[model samples]
Target: MRVVTMLHVEGELDQSRHAAIEHAVARAAGEVAGLRRSHLGRHYPGTVGGGQYTWDVLFDGRDPAALRQAPALLELVEEGALRLDTVAFERQHLSVPEPGIRDCVKRTLLLRVLPDTPPEAVERFERDMLGMPRYIDAIRNWAFSRADPELHPTPWTHVWEQEYRELRGLQEDYMLSPYHWGLVDGWYDPESPQRIVDTNLAHVYCPAATTILGWEA
Candidate 1:
């Protein structure tokens, strides 16, 4: 089973405290026997929502109990620097139902692109690239929206969220397949400009199971 834990921190956390927390987690990442990979990062400037810091940790284990034993993980930062006002964690167990095939699960990847050209040109380019036949199977559904001022400051940015059922070899296919050619062609527009913001990608593991940690009506 694979667990994806998302932690959101409220308020402005002290730098020293943040560093301490990161260090602790890094240590755990190295020592934990079941951890596969872990990522910790802060929200982009001008992002919406209250939580400014987010941490995503992935663990390959039978259950979440394996991660619960790491006491010193967040202790140092919690001592006097910051308090965890809110925490959102989720776990998804990985399974292969068939004899030779892995169970189909939902995985979402976020892509933030900044084109050197005009918004319309960029949109056209994306449509042409993603409209390719080879990519037709890889992309389940996608949406493009401008970064809201209340959500982010990146101008004319587009967010691509893609869902894949099976991605074992899709990464390579996406890089060298016909899809790449389409991207190159679309990027040839004269209006292409330098990107102002960094691109961020997050891998979220989705299973047949889910639980809501916090919600309000």
Candidate 2:
């Protein structure tokens, strides 16, 4: 299973708190029961809403309780040192199959489709979103999944994740493509009748050395 936990430092993080928090988070991750790999870092400059840092973790199984009981993590939140949002989903429908694992930039979009949306419209939204990679070649590998609301309690309904060889692949090719701005973007554009996504969405990316999209199983 793959889970993404994003955080924003709530206030000034002096050097001392910074070191302690970093160490605490590292220790917590190592102790989590099903943890396989952990990627924690500030997002690349080009993206938005991904918070200050993203803790993208992979697990052998879904152990929600164990993740919550992560040692010393609650104290940081209590101390007003960090703000967090997390979503976990493992059943991925690949829009673009991965080439292979290598050093790359990992990006994720966590969005919400309003509960009142009719079923047919939601289906169309999903289809249009999946269609994006067909025209934007920079999206080397991609998966889009609907998150289970029971697991996270966050309103987010879907997760869109992908990897690019470099930032320019996303910044220039993907962002600048006609399919993005002209075609698939309507689902996210508030002014458009096709919009299904909540305006408050997370667009975050970070440097990754291994494939976080999970090709193994």
Candidate 3:
């Protein structure tokens, strides 16, 4: 039972507050059962998508109820440090070769399907998304979800996540993969108002330390 918690951060923050935020998150990580990995990342400035900073918490064999009660999460809420826009939890949906415990890069996408899109079409789109890894070998790990309104009441309905060994692979291999340009791109049109995608890439951080730094590799 893998669980991921995505926090959409808001409110004024300075360097001091930022450090405190990370500390709170780390404190929560220690208190939560099954929370083996955690990442607190700030999106690159001027990016066209995603939250300003995302707190990605990964838990194994933990329930969503327990996750909400995480000490760090509770502390943030109680202290008014976080103005959460969205909170989503998803289990592992697609299987790929595990990237193991090493440092890697990750891309997270928040998607919203047009209201006018047919239900059957939406279902088909999901099937195609799940099959993406078969065609793009650059993706080292992947997981995603079409949010359940009852559990995840966020405006976005779909969440896509993937890991890569290096950013170059993401750009040269995954982005240029025939499967992406030929098949996936056809399904998504930037010009179309019917669909929305907000993507952000970040260095992967585990319990032990921050990993996958530097852009040279």
What are the lDDT figures for the candidates, one per model? 0.40, 0.79, 0.59
Q: Could you tell me how far off, in angstroms, the CA of residue 67 lies in candidate 1 after the best superposition?
A: 24
lDDT of 1 by residue, 74-133 (tens): 553355433332121222111222222223323333334544547776557565644543
lDDT for model 1: 0.40
Per-residue alpha-carbon lDDT of candidate 2 for residues 1-217, written as tens digits (9 for 90 to 100): 7677888777666778667767877988887887888877667776677667788777775665466468668777777777778887766687436656588888888999987999999999888888888888889888888886666666789999888988888889988999899877888899999887889889988888867675433
What RMSD does each model have against the real structure? Answer: 12.6, 2.1, 5.7
Worst 10 residues of 3 by lDDT: 208-217
Per-model TM against the reference: 0.36, 0.90, 0.70
Candidate with better TM-score, 1 vs 2: 2
Question: What residue runs in model 1 are displaced by over 4 Å at the alpha carbon?
Answer: 1-116, 129-134, 151-156, 182-217
Ranking the candidates on TM-score from highest down gives: 2, 3, 1
The most accurate candidate by lDDT is: 2
Ranking by lDDT: 2, 3, 1
Q: Return the top candidate by TM-score.
A: 2
